[model samples]
Target: MRKSYLKLFGLACMLTIVSCSLDDDRVNFQYTPLQITGASLPDTFELGRVYTVDVNILRPDDCTLLDQFDVRRSFTDTTQIRTISAVGIVLDKDECAALNDSLQDAFQFEVLYTKPYIFRFYTSDDSEGEPEFLEIEVPVKE
Candidate 1:
């Protein structure tokens, strides 16, 4: 029994040492909220149809890449308002290049409801550190 216990202890120590031998300089990344500068949407949408909107995003640095679009809809109201924002992946690195131009991406969504959709894109923060949005209402044609 004593010999078995000694073998288990030695095995645990070896496993710990092997795990600690992993590279410490592994690539690190974080999800960051990106600013939506502008969006090119259609004048109107037809029901039961799919549409694509080109969204312009303000890239803070070259290390930032488009990750996903955060689209939230208000179920409490029947207005069909959707609050959308762009999220980016920022690589945690010591050196990052600055971006001079904005990046554009396409966002595709299907129109299910006949009511108009009020799309509010998150633009930037105001003077009081409040979030400002670019609101656009698009009517639907049945």
Candidate 2:
């Protein structure tokens, strides 16, 4: 009877392993290759005014944060631009998570001058894939 009980236990363990692996085909969602589904900015912005802007980041699953940002300036027109480094802007991770899309993302920026600038933000997962980013134009006036 002892030998029979041991055999039953081993069979049960094997069945459990097989059953779990059988669901491997379920979705197989990956977090890489993130996309920015939305970008929001005010139609009119004034110099030295703090403003809240948002970008909707999307992933196949809900498992990442909006990581970093870059600022640039358009020289003659929107076509030609250069990256401008400055501070006073931050990523609101908590707010991003509460917004639309699988992953939430938005940035709060304080305008330093009355000039047009380009803002870029990046997002990624912990495991893999190249960084994905989005850029928005901030047109400021005096």
Candidate 3:
């Protein structure tokens, strides 16, 4: 009787441990990775040409659709004639880091005016780190 009771107790303990270890795989995890593939404008633009700037966001390997905004852009100097639409996106830290490897070689637009033009893309939270800036020389159209 004593041995039987001990065996039952041990079995119950094992079962409890196993049950706790099993997580519901059916439940989707909330953590999703976001990334940016490329963001740029045309290489050349005519004077006083109004063009829309395109910012591209890439979907993570595990997800589809880049429908989030943690990325924003602003002109460093206000004296420039260029303007960006208010419809900018934001990206999370994880999402930003995922693109860090690829962003170095990403396409960049050249500022073609006499005034110094700087485009800055900042993370959602400034406290996270300093914002990234792209300085381009706006060439004066002859």
Candidate 4:
């Protein structure tokens, strides 16, 4: 009877250790990106032209937060003479309004300029993995 009790105690202790180890291996937590908004424009933005676009971001739960996030643009026609970059610089409402006003009625812009304009969000833990990406096509006018 004593031997049987010892065996049962040993089994219980083993089970407790296994349960603790299982909990440590769990990575159920996650991160997300909330709202993402931006635009695109013609090669040369002309004053008084209307550039239209549909701006939307990935759902928050779908994306992971990171130390840095960047947007990359690549034009389909290399000969089209255009430049694209992420709108990283901070601009006040007046400046944004001015830009919109300038592009309100001068040139024709479309969202199909490139194949992949990637939005990459770099994880703070660089050692762990690469940043997540969200692709978008924004419209612009000149």
Question: What lDDT score belongs to each candidate, Candidate 1 first?
Answer: 0.90, 0.54, 0.42, 0.35
Q: Estimate, for each residue in 45-88, the C-alpha lDDT of model 4 and write its tens digit.
A: 33344454323332222212222233333345432222222222
How does each model score on TM-score? 0.83, 0.42, 0.32, 0.21
lDDT score for residue 2 of model 2: 100
Clashing pairs in 1: none
Please tell me which predicted candidate would have the highest TM-score against the true structure. 1
Error at 67, model 3, angstroms: 4.6
Measured over all alpha carbons after superposition, the RMSD of each candidate to the real structure, in angstroms, is 2.8, 12.7, 12.7, 17.0
Candidate 1 per-residue lDDT, tens place, 36-119, comes to 999998999999999998999999888899899999987435569999989999998899999845999988989999889999
lDDT tens digits by residue: candidate 2, 32-123: 33455556778767888888766565543233434443555456544323332212223323333333345445557777755577655554
Off by over 4 Å in 4: 18-29, 36-55, 59-142
Of candidates 4 and 2, the better by TM-score = 2
Q: How would you order the candidates by TM-score, starting with the best? A: 1, 2, 3, 4
In candidate 4 the C-alpha lDDT for residue 90 amounts to 30
Give stretches of model 1 more than 4 Å off: 1-17, 21-23, 75-78
At residue 33, candidate 2 shows an lDDT of: 34
